[model samples]
Target: MEQDLLPKLKETSVLIMDNATFHKGKRLQELIRCAGHYIVWLPKYSPDLNPIEKMWSRVKMIRNKFRVKDIDKLFKDYCNDLFGI
Candidate 1:
């Protein structure tokens, strides 16, 4: 985030993120604040409020259907199929 996303921000912004353990780190919060942005944690267990949750659910379903063994390849293929990336 610091190396890529943060430096591209054109102005101060509010970052809404899920309550992932890594996201709550003191150093991460400090880095965001130091960049003149604010952090807002999503409510716990509120999957409907997080758009990524829907995508993750779909990914999980697809993985189960395909019985994928290689996650890195699955993710790459899925992204390429879904977003032409």
Candidate 2:
């Protein structure tokens, strides 16, 4: 999933993430670090402070609209469209 995002990132970016176990994997950390983007872990229970939360809402709405069987691909494509990635 992080691999898909690499193409969308700017030379310098700050990736704000929640404290999900999958989000903190060593491989993903290394990927972001190598890409020269820093990670900022958002505090628990502060979805209001995160722009991705809003993005997720938008994505979910689109997902529900399409009723896709392959949600992962749909999400990536939808995000790419939404953000012009």
Candidate 3:
């Protein structure tokens, strides 16, 4: 999975990733080094400081209104709800 993600990420200038075990792997390190892109990792156990975490929390609250059957609708409505229409 990381290998597949590497090519797309290479062209990007900056990426923020949470401090997780899987992302901390040596293969990922090599990928980053080869890509020559600056990577910033958030501190571990600090979801409160991450904006995406707050957004997801809001989505879960609003998602109770609708039955989710697939990824596309769920993501779309969740984003709309979070942004308040």
**C-alpha TM-scores of all predictions:** 0.82, 0.56, 0.63
Q: If ranked by TM-score, best first, what sequence of candidates would result?
A: 1, 3, 2
Alpha-carbon shift of residue 48 in model 2 (angstroms): 2.1
For model 2, residues 1-85, the per-residue Cα lDDT tens digits are 5658877876799888898899989999998888899999998889898877898888788788777779787877797778877
State the weakest 10-residue window (summed lDDT) of model 3: 1-10
TM-score of 1: 0.82
TM-score top scorer: 1
In model 1, which residue pairs have backbone atoms overlapping below 3 Å?
none
Query: For this target, which candidate reaches the highest lDDT against the unseen true structure?
Result: 1
RMSD of each: 2.3, 5.5, 3.3
lDDT of 3 by residue, 1-85 (tens): 4557667764656667887788788878667766876678898899976888987777777667777777788888887776755
Best of the two (1, 3) by lDDT: 1
User: For residues 5-77, what per-residue lDDT tens digits would candidate 1 score against the true structure?
Assistant: 8999989999999999999899999999999999999999999999999899889877886777998977976
Q: What order do you get sorting by lDDT, best first?
A: 1, 2, 3
Candidate 2 weakest ten by summed lDDT: 1-10
Query: On lDDT, who's better, 2 or 3?
Result: 2
Residue 25 in model 1: lDDT: 92
